[model samples]
Target: MRPAYKQILEAVVVTAELTGSELSAHAQEVMVDDLMAYPLDAVLQALTRCRKELKGRLTLAAILDRLDDGRPGADEAWGVVARALGDESETVVWTEEMAAAAAPARELMMLGDKVGARMAFRDAYERIVSDARSERRSVTWRVSPGSDAERRVAAIVRAVELGRLPAAQAQLLLPTQAVAERHLLLTGSVMTEQERRAGREHVKKLLGMLRGGKVQVARTAG
Candidate 1:
């Protein structure tokens, strides 16, 4: 453990007024080991949040919950998956946990059991998220493109705007003309017909790669 972490943990312990055997050297070592997986800044912020909000004894679980780790709650994750299920032409940017839970949910949805699919998705998502958090795995966001070109462009743009996708990487998933057009529009310029044709060819290649599973869009670390 870093000296800084040890100092912060001791500070948190004092602020929380934790007494008894909980302040033993062995217990502190265990806490440091568990917290070492997270970033120092995140750990500090979580401890600060715990200092302000915890109503009961400060526990590892409470501090973990307070970390801004970017993992969405089960209900929020389900909502994203459920929207994708309803729209075949909707592009989605999701975490690995959401994708993993989505498989079983999609299977149930295919059988016309929407309710069952939702319940299963929530349960699986929670379990997967818990395991991921325990393992100190950060969220990785990936794009799953849809068939609609316009919608795909819109989704990618929105993701980049929201900081869910990096702008540089999003360019790989978009057509050349789409990017050019957006740039031109922002600069009050226009795209030529030749440029449009070139963009179409780029789109075709992207679509082909997507079909072949050769285009693994960039993964954003959360």
Candidate 2:
């Protein structure tokens, strides 16, 4: 297979699995310059790892040659990177442990009282966003037929829990069937025992917000 094709496939697999996985903190870093987009270093690492593990399946020379030739979806790649590289996004410094995760779990205080809102992690992956060719890169479109509900639900909730989306807005992005399941999973699976107790205390808050009325469910995350 062509190096470009392999790169694209690897990106799709990683992106699809991102919902339940983690991202590193470097993804959150501010654009220090025009070049400050997707983590090439990490992508390089990934390619190298693929080469090492796949042995006969993938060759480092092929990937390296492609990288040098700018033959591996360079034009198509930049757009994905650009999306993740929004202007002036603030990124925290990277740590060794952070390098190990897909991306860092970021949080910032919202609301006047400084309640925490989670931030997106590795969703801003370099290759996914880099579309130098400016091709229309729809990661969702690449998902398998009939859609993958579990991945979708987890992603929406994560976006909401993180400051990437308004809770209501995130709710609207969910599929109708996935809504209840996601809420329960979030209200259950995401908490530590103490955190769960605190969240339960805010059951009234949850209901009150729900009382404002639900966001219309959509078929996909925009």
Q: CA lDDT of each candidate? A: 0.76, 0.37
- Put down candidate 2 lDDT per residue, 1-222, tens digits, no spaces: 555434544553453234232323232121111112223553455444544444343322223323322222322333332222332232222222222222332222223221121122233323333332124222221111114555566655654554444565555556555535445544544445675556556665777677555543332333
lDDT of 2 at 207: 72
Off by over 4 Å in 1: 1-7, 11-23, 45-62, 111-113, 181-222
Pairing residues by index, what is the TM-score of model 2? 0.21
Model 1 over residues 1-222: C-alpha lDDT tens digits? Answer: 678777667766664574222456667667867887887788888887877787777777777877778877778888889878778888888899999999889988888899999999998887787778878888888888887888888878787777787766787787544756465434445667887677678778877877666434433321
RMSD in Å for all candidates: 8.8, 20.3
